[model samples]
Target: MKLKFTLLTLFLVLISALSFAQKSNNSQSIISGKVNISKYHSREELKNLDKGELLTLYIERIEVIVNILPNIAFATKPGVTMASLGIPETKDNKKALEENKEASDTYFDSTIEFQKSILPYSDKKDLIAAILFYESTLKALHTYEDFKKD
Candidate 1:
């Protein structure tokens, strides 16, 4: 029947479109970086702060990154509500975080270099805006993706 043929054609088109999408999505790599959170507070300060203060600090910093996602918001906020739990950082973690953040910076620099390469294009403003927007979006995505781990 014509209806059956039409349905099959539509399904094939959808399958091909999905395959194309996967390829495009996989082409661009993720940016790497980890930020050390200890700089925001000293060991003395973290030790001294009560649960309420630590919770406030966590909320203040993390809120912007995860944005409106309820599931992710839930994972971060509730359990750690108890504070004065002692500092989580060690010398090793600090060194690791520093290295991760450095990698992030390097990735950012590469993106900038890419923009410079395309700067000679006629649409200067649009090109710059697009690249800048991409950078900010990537930064946010990177933070959001690494929320629980870092």
Candidate 2:
């Protein structure tokens, strides 16, 4: 009876150990699958590009914003200069501020248009970067609008 009990206990321990090992293996596979899905391009792929080619690609996409919305470059100049000079925000600055706000709206509109035009041809990483940049620009524009209201 004593030998049978000991064998039974050993058998249970082996089964539990196998179960734990299988669980860990399953968890590791799940985590590795997630990592693979999150990364669209590996380091090796990005490294395959020739020097300046990557930069040229980014500039090419960005040029759509620059070219399509020339007003964005000049319309905000006065407000930017005033803010940089530490000039107090007063009623007199409202016109310039409003112009800046309009320019920002135009810029956001142009960015949406540019994304529609360029996204189909862009790499996954570039698309991700462009989206982040667009979000940042949108946030900045909102902030500017809030500042103008004050």
Candidate 3:
């Protein structure tokens, strides 16, 4: 009986130590900061992007910007258009502009779904930044390139 008690005590100590170590590691973990848009907008790399690639990069930039910003009030209904944080929009031609807007909206909705799906598993700081930056930059590059031609 004494031998069993000693073994049980040892096991409990080991479990306690492990639990404490896990908690400490969790406490030390840090989240990544938001991406800087001004830096990306000024980047020379953007000048070389073609229409399709520019669109993709623009969307990616938007995703990164969303991740870094405060949680926004999105619509509860699917397919509903929500306000952009603060970016201004100009419609050069109504029909063409609306079509472009619709495509952009669809992309944003898809991004929200994608973010929700993978965010649960990611913990690395750079991985999170990559996800946000790639998505946002893709979208931004697309829209800006289109607008520039107007």
Candidate 4:
């Protein structure tokens, strides 16, 4: 009786442990870096990107906002002055804009914005180092271009 009871208890323990294990999600990949999604933007930031005058106009406006990022990053990396864009100081206003359900469909229609949303949860923690590591990990795992489809 004692032997049978011990064996049953061990089997139940193993089954519970396996049940709690984390499984991989098909939509995302884990690369070798980190990033902080919350620091740069919130979910609301993406929604606030447009005034939503009209569906077509809103899309165009959102596209313009999304398209300028690479250029700004490249330009600033080279130490270009604010005078180039006529702005006195450059700011990283990557905060997620508030979502407006009535304005348009899919606030984060672009891959870049979608990628930003995933950053915060990637590390499972909100520390700066975790975020940086998560950013790199994402880059190593997936391409930015594919983010939209994801």
Candidate 5:
């Protein structure tokens, strides 16, 4: 009788664990679907915008990207460290990593400033090109980040 009870208990625990795993997977899929929907809506909104409006939106989006640069830089840093307790030396290539980060910051800042300056004078084609450039950059960065997570 005790052996049968132990087997039944083990089976129940295994079933519950499997159910929990399935729920976790379902939640992840839901989140991924939401991201896709959001991207689709953004593209639709951009497509419907007039030239002047699109330029304005482009400038605003560039500003937002600039604001998030620090976070992106932090996340993509080559070295790993926990500085709170004063423990360092977690990773190597510090010099090269800092140089690459500085270069990226300079490039992004310059591109943003150039886009802002020329926005008022830009036509539909110019605006569309700028939009595509920024959008693709953002998409690439997001994909890279996701890849890093996995």
Candidate 6:
């Protein structure tokens, strides 16, 4: 009887595994093909994207900004010069960063209000592209700093 019970459990587990199995097709991915910076960053095509695609971009935008937070610390690091990081001591970059920060804050508050009000998903492609461009700038800055250290 114990052997029979074990066999039954094994069969049930196999059945459950099959039920949970995802499609094996690579082209049918919900988020589409290989995600990268090369993808077109235009807002005019937002409506053309699937719900999954928009959500994925939204998540990516958050991740990119979060990765950039350390750059703020980079500014305060001892012995790290602005020229080394390639962050020019200019009003323009600071102004752009401040604008992005305020936009980020507004986006956060708006997300909460949106959910509460049951609003439809707003396409954030423009904001995502802006943040991505900012992040790329940070990456270039870090790379410059690394090369300068050598």
> Which candidate should be chosen as best, given TM-score against the real structure?
5
Which structure is stronger by TM-score: 3 or 4? 3
**Which clashing pairs does model 2 show?**
none
For residues 10-82, could you state the per-residue lDDT of candidate 6 as single tens digits? Answer: 9999987887673331121111111233343445565566656755555554444443444444542234444
lDDT of each: 0.44, 0.47, 0.46, 0.36, 0.55, 0.50
lDDT value for candidate 6? 0.50
lDDT of 5 at 4: 100
Query: 6-99, model 1: which lDDT tens digit per residue?
Result: 9999999999999999655321111122221323444455556554454444433333322222223422222321112343345564465456
Clashes of each: 0, 0, 27, 24, 0, 0
- The digit string of per-residue lDDT tens for model 4 on 1-150 reads 999999999999998778766332121111111111222323344334332222222223334333333233323122333344444332332111112211223433544366445543432223333333433543333354455473
Q: Which stretches of candidate 1 lie over 4 Å from their true place?
A: 1-87, 122-150
What TM-scores do the predictions have? 0.29, 0.29, 0.34, 0.20, 0.40, 0.29
The superposed Cα distance between candidate 3 and the true structure at residue 108, in angstroms, equals 6.3
Deviating ranges (above 4 Å) for candidate 3? 28-48, 71-109, 112-150
In model 2, the worst 10-residue window by lDDT is 27-36
Model 2 regions more than 4 Å off: 1-89, 129-150
Predicted structure 2, TM vs. truth: 0.29
lDDT rank order: 5, 6, 2, 3, 1, 4
Give per-residue lDDT, candidate 6, residue 6: 100
lDDT of 2 by residue, 1-150 (tens): 999999999999999999999655311110100000121233455457653454444444354334323433323222234444455555566465556546655765687577566656766566446534643443353345455553
Model 1 gets an lDDT of 0.44
TM-score of model 5 relative to the true fold? 0.40
Q: List the residue pairs that clash in candidate 6.
A: none
- Give the Cα-based TM-score of candidate 4 against the true structure: 0.20
The number of clashing residue pairs in model 4 is 24
Error of 2 at 102 (Å): 0.6
RMSD of each: 21.1, 20.9, 18.4, 20.7, 13.4, 17.0
